[model samples]
Target chain A: MHVPVLKQGDYLIASVQSVLSDADLVQLRDDLAERVGQFRSRGVIIDVTVLDVIDSFATRTLRAVAHMLKLRGAETVIVGIQPDVAFAMVQLGLTLEGVGTALDLEEGLAYLDRLARKPVKHGK
Target chain B: MENNEACVSINSAADIVTARQKGRALALELGFDGSDLTLIATAISEVARNIVNHAKSGEIVVSPMNHSNKRGILVVARDEGPGIKDIAKAMQYGYSTNKGLGVGLPGAKWLMDEFDIESKVGKGTTVTMKKWLH
Candidate 1:
């Protein structure tokens, strides 16, 4: 499945519309990381609205991808998770902890924008 | 009694996607609504992924069923791989032997109305799940 990752300003928006396999997911992770570097993006919005199923592996991969992007100085937001998919994920205990989530792509982009506006504090 | 039974083989990640799509199509044909269809499809994906990740090969059977005044769909995923040594432990949340999230089995169970598991050590594992058309 082809996943289009488009750069808008300083944020990268990836709309995932395919039923991804393990290899495809791995490739996406690598691809997104590379894009983040090449584009010098400060945030990413991953849209999964079209997916009917978000299995355990996919959930984990998303979480891992978000974590990786965070390490690369980019904030990540997941949007468009269907209600049934959310129910199954929670029931199965795949809470996708520590990952930022929004209701839709618009909200995701806005959330990232808000994050970008926050003043950076040096050192904890 | 099994009727309108369909089966799909699982050997790779691509097969998992196919099995879930087939499950969703079968459930849709059985008059399952959107939520029910997603639930069934997600359940199928979990079990089929297990076959690819742990078993290396397996089969998923989807069938329409009727009992009393109720109608539903049945899904059976069977894999001949290294069987689960501790079924109970494996069913617990966040318990994964393969360094995974350990939610496949238990999560699948929660997605369906009825769930059953059968496995033998050093043999294989079989999971049967059903979702009623409500």
Candidate 2:
């Protein structure tokens, strides 16, 4: 299952197109982290609408992805978690806490845009 | 018995995906709804992952069943690897010796209607879970 990461302006969009295995999830994390620097991306949007189940492994790997992007001075937003998947995640105690999430691709882009419009933190 | 059963071997992380996908497909054919299908699929993923992570290899078996006219899906994950030293500790939430969230087993239990596990030190482990079509 390949997750295609597309570069859009200063943001990156990685849309999951199929059921991803553990190896695939790790590959995605590394791929995005590398692209964030190679492309000098400011934000990332991961579309998971195609995913039917996001279990513990997937959740942890995604958290790692977001954390890695943040360390590289890039923000990450996960979008398109189905309602049933969300309910299962909640029951499994797999809340994507500390990670930004939006309803879909449009909201994710809007969120990133709003963050970009704000003044840079600190005195920089 | 014609099309009510399926089995997938769990070896690598890739097998986890296969097992869960097959589980979801079987569950759907068994008349499980949207959320229930997701729940069953997630539960299978967790158990199958355990087989790969700890046992190195195993298998997941899923089948449709009936409990007094109440249809349900049964999932059984079996592996012959280093058994859990403390099943209780392993089942507890947030308890993990491996580099994981430690919620795989417990979370899987929460997602299913019925859950059971058996293990022996230095022997192996088997996890059986069920989800009713509700």
Best by lDDT: 2
Query: Candidate 2, after superposition: displacement of residue B16 in Å?
Result: 0.7
Per-residue lDDT tens digits of candidate 2, residues A52-117? 999999999999999999999888999999999999999999988889999999999999997745
What tens-digit string does per-residue lDDT give for candidate 1 at A7-113? 89889999887777778788888989999999888999999998888888989999999999999999999999999888767766677788899999999989999
Per-residue accuracy of model 1 over B1-134 as CA lDDT, tens digit each: 34467899998888988899888988988899877887888889889988888899999999998889999999999989998898999888778878998888988998899999999998999999988877
The fraction of correct interface contacts reproduced by each prediction comes to 0.83, 0.98
User: Candidate 1 clashing pairs?
Assistant: none
lDDT of 2 at A22: 83
User: How many steric clashes between backbone atoms does each model show?
Assistant: 0, 0
